[model samples]
Target: MRPREHASQIPPTRSASIETVLVVTMDHLPGYEIREVLGQVVSSQARTRNVYREGVKSLRGGAYDPAAPENLTRWRTDAVARLGEEARRLGANAVLGMRFEHREVGEMWMEVCAYGTAVVAYRSPAAPAPDQPLVAAETAHPAEPIDSGAIAEAPSAPNLRTAGETPTRPD
Candidate 1:
């Protein structure tokens, strides 16, 4: 039987269409305020592996290549893109705490899943102009100074003894 050609290799030049939605692994985006939480979003992709090719390659004493088409990185990227698209469809501008998961189905199939919390966020307004210096309120109660004499002394360290030995008075 003729070996099947490797398919589903993501072209290096093609964009994943992830530009519309912002994705972050953190729960909150710095400098941006979340206006609304739109709930969780997820995407999944499953691919079949050519076990014959892999078995033949292993028999030939060839080590698996990390960059080969069999690697799940490409699928993971696609999953993230789909996740972003889902977020966009839900009217969310961003996905926070983005995460990826991988699973194997029996022996020939594998799946990649991506998930995150969708949210609508906007850039936070700039800090108030430097002209208005922040000041403490005059009516606020002041903290009282600590008095050294009023504090109780720290307890002395306990004497440690060996497993079966009794404490002996000093000679």
Candidate 2:
């Protein structure tokens, strides 16, 4: 039998659709504040081995191209898309503290679950003018002086080496 054609070797599309839900592993967006909590959302997909493919793989014996499958890339794309759908359904524009879990189902199937807290995050309002002082001039705390004590009160320990010296291990 002829070998199966390889899936396109091009990089997989990594982004979701036009809505562009911000799904991330971090709990907080760096420049945005979470305006509303929309609760948790999740999605999953199952993958099973194809017996015909496995037979071909076994027959090829030691010919496995470790990186050929790119299964994670495919799975991640699917999971993220599904997660984005779920988040949108919950009226959330972003998923925060996102994480994934994987498990082997019985012997032949694998399942991946993606989950996170859904929330609406918006950029916080600009701050008040920088030079405006909040406190009265008389009550401002005074700066304290720094005092560095004298050095070399105790004898210097031995084996301090110069830049060119190789260090020796202690016996």
Candidate 3:
């Protein structure tokens, strides 16, 4: 049997491609379980407006166009596309906790960065079964829940400050 080819080489069908490389701002995705915790993936691009486009805009009395750099839709699309490419390189199917940021490099140039944690996610297989507490048929009250020590212990540390003294690290 032959192994499957890379997903990028073969374009995904519409419905399948919609979820192929998800980029979500949320830390967790609904109905999808993260199977692996891949490391960070980042992509960035810097761009300046085309001289011809700027000339056209100036000729039009500086009127706003949907594609202007200030509007940034094009730059964002390019950056996110690059980000998805990086995630795919990592063998990740989705990117979680994704974020976008921009910085001005000069009077005319700006840079945009897209970053997130790459992860492999699978659709949740089954609806969770609601757990029912075992109880006596004749009991009028619910049984007390046992303490499972789920709460984490606080780390041991010295006091933040001593009385009549500024808070400082010990010598």
- The local lDDT score (0 to 100) that residue 16 gets in candidate 3 is 32
Query: C-alpha displacement of 92 in model 1, angstroms?
Result: 0.4
Candidate 1, run of 10 with poorest lDDT: 1-10
Best by lDDT: 1
Ranking by lDDT: 1, 3, 2
Tens digits of lDDT, candidate 3, 1-171: 011223432233233323357778999977777778789999988877577877888899998875765458767777777877777777777789999999988767779999999887777766543474433321333354433654322234334566447565889
Best by TM-score: 1
TM-score of each: 0.61, 0.59, 0.57
Q: Runs in model 3 with CA error above 4 Å?
A: 1-19, 51-66, 69-71, 128-171
Q: What lDDT score is found at residue 126 in candidate 1?
A: 72
Candidates 1 and 3, the one with greater lDDT: 1
lDDT of 1 by residue, 1-171 (tens): 100111111111134475557778999877777877889999988878778767877897987755556467678778888987888788777789999998988788888899999877766777545476532221122254444555322234233455346566889
lDDT of candidates 1 onward, in order = 0.69, 0.66, 0.68
For model 2, how does the per-residue alpha-carbon lDDT over 1-171 read when each residue is reduced to its tens digit?
A: 100111121112346351446788999876667777889999899988666666777899946755436886678678878887787676677788889998989767888889999877666566434575433221232243223442222133344557358566879
Instruction: Tell me which of candidates 1 and 2 scores higher on TM-score.
Output: 1
**lDDT of candidate 3 at residue 63, scale 0 to 100:** 88
Q: Show how many residue pairs clash in every candidate, following the order shown.
A: 0, 0, 0
Q: In model 1, which regions exceed 4 Å deviation?
A: 1-16, 128-171
